[model samples]
Target: MAKNTGKAYEEFVRTIQQSLITAEGMSHLKNIEVETNKKLTDRNGIERQFDVYWEFDLGGYVYKTVIECKDYASSITVEKIDAFIGKTADIPGLRLIYATKTGYQSGASIKAEQHKIDLLIVREADEREWTAEDGTPLIKTIQLNIVALTSPRITSFAPNVDTDWLEKQKDLNADIINHAFTSSLNNEIFISNESTGHKFSLFDLSHLLLKKIPDIQYGKGTFSEELDNSYLETKAGDIKIKIKGYKLDYEYHAPITTSSVIDYSKDLLGIVEKYNTGTKQMIFKDGKIK
Candidate 1:
């Protein structure tokens, strides 16, 4: 099957013009109108049908632009260019443009140049011409990588204590770890070291764990951190306990990776610009001039 390369000539040009008006961020351009079989009379009261047309306001004056799209497989000839000039001659201040896929003959080019009729080759883009002035290759499609982050969570936090000092405190319970932790006003587990007046909590641990890693975990994972020669202040009569280390039941939340390809080939490929009449060609891609 043939590739889905394009649409009807008139509608295709209309679509391209509309997109450029929006993409170029112009405020004075009107919507492109496609009148394939419909006859719309101009100011001269003459019925003149067009393939595609639009208008724009500049220099305090509105300029009417029209495109005569020819879908013939063969190159346009001088006869066709002459016919177009005669057809549009009566219209005053009209900006006439002729577009085709195949191209035009030398005679047609001479006639079009003499008449100042813009000629363009608008069709599917080929690799040969898909390049910028800086020798950078243009692409019809691009792959975009997407990343979503999930913050790591703490499942458990236990402070180490000195058994010798535990026996001296009569107010301590048999399960010292349970009595050592207290829930904050926000219901988060919180504790502090009396020796250094440092506060430690589950929220703090979550942030600290992230800082220790080079990158976030790829998927569901676990981690345990331990410290030596440390002390923890407990809720049991604000008792200060010497801790050998800390036991943390931690699993880092995984970062999800996804990718998508944006194909501008279908969105736009042909009609880089009007190449005839000494007009320079340009293509807009990836939000920058490639």
Candidate 2:
């Protein structure tokens, strides 16, 4: 099980490594090779295996980078960073990166900075403002329908007309109305009109519906409205429906931002140390590191 887990993690690291390289515009580096579980012999003839290894050339100089993947539940310690630094000393010009799922300990970050090694934390991207095709901030919208029944209860709420629009409604009604329920107030029923493509979840739809149509049980008859961009219609028969149109929801992948490089020919260590100290001071004052 441990072996299988390690292989799975190696594959994941390889995939992310390739993506990061390409996304960061490092693909121009010649002889760009990314490998998993690559073995190398040290000066003392001791074999060391790396989780993910990469090498490339830039400006006529070839550089090697060794990435260590730690799929640990807890944060990585400074001891691990020290061991990795020792390995780097054995192999000259070996740029080191420590990737951890749970991030690094406080000392680990300082140690990594001292060694001029990169520390990367793997996790889900946080929710942020995202724009759509027309530069409008993408939003999730939900439309729901609440029906008032007089005598008979609605067992099913299928689309009435056989038009193309109504045919689409038939399938949508099946998807949403399956969760419909009959209330005790004069056999009145509440059915939501849920259609995909809006990226809204069912809980979000329900919350929006309650806010928009607060008095669902007071209405006597059916009503319909045609707004500028949306429509709300109602039909009465064996099953009454007060619902709105729906569209399919789509998933969007955000583009990665480019990273700035620190030139090693300059005072790289001094710059890194100053930056780290400034970051910690900022965190102490503003309650955030970045």
Model 2 alpha-carbon miss at residue 264, Å: 38
lDDT of 2 by residue, 1-290 (tens): 34536566666667666655665667876546689989888888888888899888778877888888777888889999988888767777788887765667889889899888877754322212234456776433333444432321222232232244445555457434443323222123323333421333223433343344454443232222221222222222244333343322212223334444432222111110122333211111111222
Candidate 2, residue 22: Cα displacement in angstroms equals 1.6
Model 2 earns a TM-score of 0.43
Which pairs clash inside model 1? Answer: none
RMSD of 1: 6.1
TM-score of 1: 0.64
- The prediction achieving the highest TM-score against the true structure is 1
Give me the candidate number with maximum lDDT: 1
